[model samples]
Target: MGRRKSQRKNVAMLDSDEDNSSVSSSSTARSDLMSVSGAGDVQVDKDSLLEQALDALYEKRGSTREKALAAIIEAFNTNLRHQFVEKKFATLLHQCLNSIKKGSSKEIALGCHAIGLLALTVGSGDHAREILEESVAPISHALKSSSDSLKTVSLLECLAVVTFVSATETEETERSMQIMWQLLHPKLGSNVVAVKTPAVVVTAVVSTWAFLLTTMDGCSLNSKDWQESISYFSTLLDKDERSVRISAGEALAVIFETGIEKLAAENKTTPDGSILEGNKYRQGYTHILGLKSKILNQVRSLSAEAGGKGSTKKDLNSQRNLFKDVLEFLEDGYIPDISMKIGGNSLHMSTWSELIQLNFLKHFLGGGFVKHMQDNELLHDVFGFTPKRKNILGVEHQMTSGEKRMFQSPNSVLNKARTQFLNKQRMLSKDRNVGHFAFGMGDEDSR
Candidate 1:
């Protein structure tokens, strides 16, 4: 009876486990179906979704318009563009133009931004050229009549974007480039460098120039304009925006590929430095190499770019700094000799920069700012180097005793004070304890 009861219990446990497993499997299957169903629901027709977004975009509230614009971008991303573009781009372009004409500054900016994405997607086709041709009137009007700098910036951005469309007709690039120059003529000629223009506008202009160069790959048929553009961009190396500097660099790079490459290769060089002293570039390319060198060095430098993100005054990294050569220039012009080995009896001495560095370090360590520091004795090792007193370059340097007191002194004031104390102690020792005795010591003033 007991054995039969145990078997019945085991069989009941197996039946319960099977029931739980079946229930879990059904739940898992239902969840998978629901997830798939949710994705399919999201993958609705792009046209209907875009039309809905357009309606939402045209709502009265700016907040609603923002969401609608965002939704349109999302739809564009999902639709693979060319397919959906063929279907609804005409409608989308019409909406954007209407928005630019009738919408607020914010709406206009979004519309212009959307056009950039659309241009990038349909890079080379009649679609791009058509949009570029059609935008000239409204954009030109906006540029002239819009009191809002933001709106002007938007129109400029849109024009810049439209030019990326790779027009498929003869002389289209030339016409596009000329129209762009006219539109940007005012801002590009300003004396304030880049301070007057927004960073986005500068970026747009620069990238547009680069795009122009990219489309026209030849012996730079318009070398004069290219030179003027290159010169203008060279001034932007010191702009307050990293993106602008980057854009300028990119534009210059495009020009370099087109025109300036051969000139840089023909410069004279000295063995000691990498920089070429004589810039022999023709009038068109004179400043290009200098600017190019700066740009190349700027990117690799660890120095914080002005107005760059999270930068502070202490973010300087000078290990590979190219402009450190400027210091050499200063030294050569002002310094008679480096004094790397000043000598009294043919002994080596400190370099001039080394002495300055030492004095500065001593002052820094002894300053009140470091008064609360701990373990400062570690800095004592810096004083271990002994500099000799001798004239450099075989020229005798004239110095008054007071002047000599300043530079010829040991670099550390603490070491000077310690030496005086030790000398006084030794003198006192000789005077005080010749015959005196201590409790268990040989003399009362022994070391």
Candidate 2:
């Protein structure tokens, strides 16, 4: 009777173990079903009732993760209202960015694009700063991802967000500027997909820099930094990629405009109360002027080489287009300050004259293009008298003896004549119909 009782206890224990196993298996099945249902809810077909649900979520201004994603998609769609979409999307963007700290890679990338769309939209407001700060780690990680598309999208989105943030006048703008400056270095700017990225990012960066330098509020970038920016852009101009070249040209135009303004401002200011009182600033102005000349020369050399044989016509066209852009920039009242001051100095006169002559030649070659430099008075000052130098390929080649002598004295009559010549040439060039005698061939051959 003792052995039988022990066997019965053992059988009872086995039955209890089977019952517990059945309960555990049932619990696992319920858990799996719940997980599947949750996944199914999130994974709606692109063209099903799910789209309607997403639309409804966006319409209702839902702040849940699903709603935020739907709003982002709506912003990216081509058929949205500019103002309404931007405002609603910005609201969702803030919520999404706040969650990015704990989000997955896909989540972060989606957030980045949402911010990018906000940047593209007008009236993004102060939210750009918040997005930029929150995106730093995620963007950096995305940039390092093994997937090329992820890296490209991350770069473009980061560029847009930072650009919008830097445009504002708040103290937080500096953070965005710093991030942009770091990204613009050779390591990042020269990224493998630099060619394939959208032009908006490059354009935004250039515009932001221009605004910063021209305005008093933004941090002053050093000359070396500025030079590096130019160098990187210059390299981009030489890239085999067409879009990159076009974007580089646009950026260069902005830089040239700002540089011209800075140069003019420096030239006008004096240590004394009087504008006529020449001060130490002249040396600084002269150095800047030299730098400008160097940059222009480099551009000219690049343009020439890029336009040579074996190059595609499209490539040559781009180089010519860049040259035209530079000319247009210089024409926009840049040299007037110096021109007015040195009107009585022969060397100054000669220099202005040469610049005018080059402008005329370029205009003639660039399909009847006329720049702002070709105003009436500037034309007379440039071409009123005999050219000091003989015309070479429609450009004045050398200064004459009288011009050279005037260049020696600060207030010589020849200097005055030189200025008058420049003013006349400017006027003549202004009249697009006026034929450049220097460039015109004799009619004897036609007869």
Candidate 3:
């Protein structure tokens, strides 16, 4: 009787049809999984078995996350147990989030996996979307807090799942994308490699691009897409991380092929391609064209040499294989019916325009642009809205009266110009006052 009762506990996947999940149905072999609650020791204290598991999950001392993980995974493993978690999904999410933030490293790992699994299997219904909304909290925390590569990888894997599954039609999609990028951009530097390998970072990045695709409902391609992600990928061609560079090359090749095809189609068949002087899209195709031209030459040039000492053609071929596809695809003049599901990321089109106006094409795009950039801080006043740096800092050294403004320094060109203008005004005022003084009304004589 006890054995039969144990079999009836709620511990399984969100919806266990296995139709959409990458995990095989055969992988779940535990028929008496509820037996894991210690056969008879895990006496039910709550109305639901899953709640009982949660109670155990938050126990003050000596409680292992193994039980909590097993119970949650079991809930996600089969169709029957999914309802229990769904009913208490909010509680379930909170417990997992708490584990991620405050639990031991083992607990944190399980929490990461749990959130990932929820994202992977949670159906995209209204309630499911609500549950998914909770993902941003853990992801934000994990990205900032992960101290090691494996832990970072776990968090990134969760991100991959979240991005993949949440590509549904919704108002939240764009907001989520923005938030993800804001969090991701800061963590993409070489410093991330201190926490994780370059390949792991690349995989996380590729997963992010899955969200950048225009095919995702309610999302469309933007210029920033190229700047934020694709541009970075282009520069990675020369990175020490061979796998990262190779992956970046593949992405660039797809983008180049797709872009040229789109431009050609617009001009050839679309009756009115009068969008710009040199391109059909707008006056903005220059950067795309420039990027396309440079990347092709750069990748082709890479193939001409057996790079590194004693490297064979095989070595060279493997390294530049992505470019081989680009070369063949271009030579054949082939355009596919469907474009690759990827786009770029940037703060705004203005950021690109600013760079271009700075003669970005004639010179290298700049080492600063290649490295870390926060949209808010980097371009708060891209064209100088605030006082000059020297003006602000030089104020203290002068030791002037309190009346002078911080920006009113003698060193600044603008300040010098302002001072000349002010002196001229003061001289004119003195001349006018002299006339009034000499003309002598009764008050002037008294003075």
Candidate 4:
């Protein structure tokens, strides 16, 4: 019985020794594969091998799993730095992103790490755009994954790349804008990771929107789609997240700046007519004029209500920064040019003059008033009227009794007097021309 037990023990020892030797041999082989390097080789094959090893580790346990992850990350970093001229490197990146899409939780995490590395290397080029579109599905899926850290960090990195590369093209800009809209819209519900991601993604979206709005050419601002987007962003400003509030504020500024010209244009005409005879234009103008005040008021109220707890200063600063863009647009000739009609009629000059005076634009050299004057040469274009370069300085010192009464009267009475003056001027010019012709005919008969 003792001899039989010894034989069994010897067999167990031999099995244990073989197992140890196999593990050591496997570790050494993995180490050699990881360490292999070549000159002028962008390490594309290395990344693929590392990815395969990581896939294997998904089913692995204990120390093998840690080594697998380390190898994958190291390989990704090396390939990310590889020259763009190398086709193999690009293929490897695409492969890695794809693998992440198909990976489980652990694999997905490593994939996000790879994504971050790729983002740092990709430039604003066609290659970058292709990669971005290809990775969008995967990154979006990851965003909805239950892993908060992986989703948040990976989506943030992806957003940065998309925004940076697509800032100049309208189609690209619009596509990215749609994605951002989806991310921010409250009705889309919440992603698994968004609840904990703060508003980094929101900030990136706002920044990208602003950049595109400011840079794109011939971009229309009156689309209902943009209005809905602005509404979504506005709602985010009221979110419990401070980052979201600030980001929303910045985005509002961008929209207002880019859309201000369109708003002013809309305010210059009515749907049924070519002029502002209706109050629709006025109402639209009033709404736009109130936006700044509303935003400022919100900032003040939030500061007061928060009682030193929230990020009141950051919010205020963002509002102020955004307001600067609006002010710049206003200073630029974005205000409505109310002095002239599309068909060249200025019978409404009084109304336009009043608007200019009210807006304090007449005193400025460049604004809506200046733009109108320059565009139509309004001073020289009116029928039967020409403005003197110099006003009649001595005559204006005298005032009629009616004129004195007008000075003391209300605006309505003053307007009525101005209308009467225009009517009388028109009639007198007609009478003077008729009398001159009659006098000339009588003189010819006497001769």
- By lDDT, the best candidate is 1
Model 1 pairs whose backbones collide: none
lDDT tens digits by residue: candidate 1, 374-431: 1112112222223222366755444444543343212222233322332332233223
* Count of backbone collisions in candidate 1: 0
Question: What lDDT does candidate 4 reach at residue 346?
Answer: 35
Root-mean-square deviation of candidate 2: 30.0
Candidate ranking under lDDT, highest first, comes to: 1, 3, 4, 2
Give the per-residue Cα lDDT of candidate 3 at 403: 26
lDDT per residue for candidate 3 within 73-155, as digits (tens), equals 55543322344545666777777778777776667766776665554333334434555677767666776776565566556
Per-candidate local distance difference test: 0.45, 0.39, 0.43, 0.41
- Please tell me which model should have the higher lDDT, number 1 or number 3: 1
Candidate 1 Cα lDDT to native: 0.45
Residue 317 in candidate 3, Cα distance off native in Å: 9.5
1 or 4, greater by lDDT: 1
Top model by TM-score, which number?
A: 3
Name the runs in model 4 displaced over 4 angstroms: 1-85, 104-113, 116-124, 141-150, 166-168, 186-218, 223-226, 229-235, 238-240, 269-286, 300-447
Worst 10 residues of 4 by lDDT: 1-10
Q: Per-residue lDDT for 13-126 in model 4, tens only? A: 112223343122333434534543212233344444554554545443534443454454454333332333233445545555655666555555555554544433333344
Which portions of model 2 miss their true places by more than 4 Å? 1-75, 81-91, 94-110, 119-153, 156-158, 165-167, 170-174, 184-245, 268-284, 301-316, 331-447
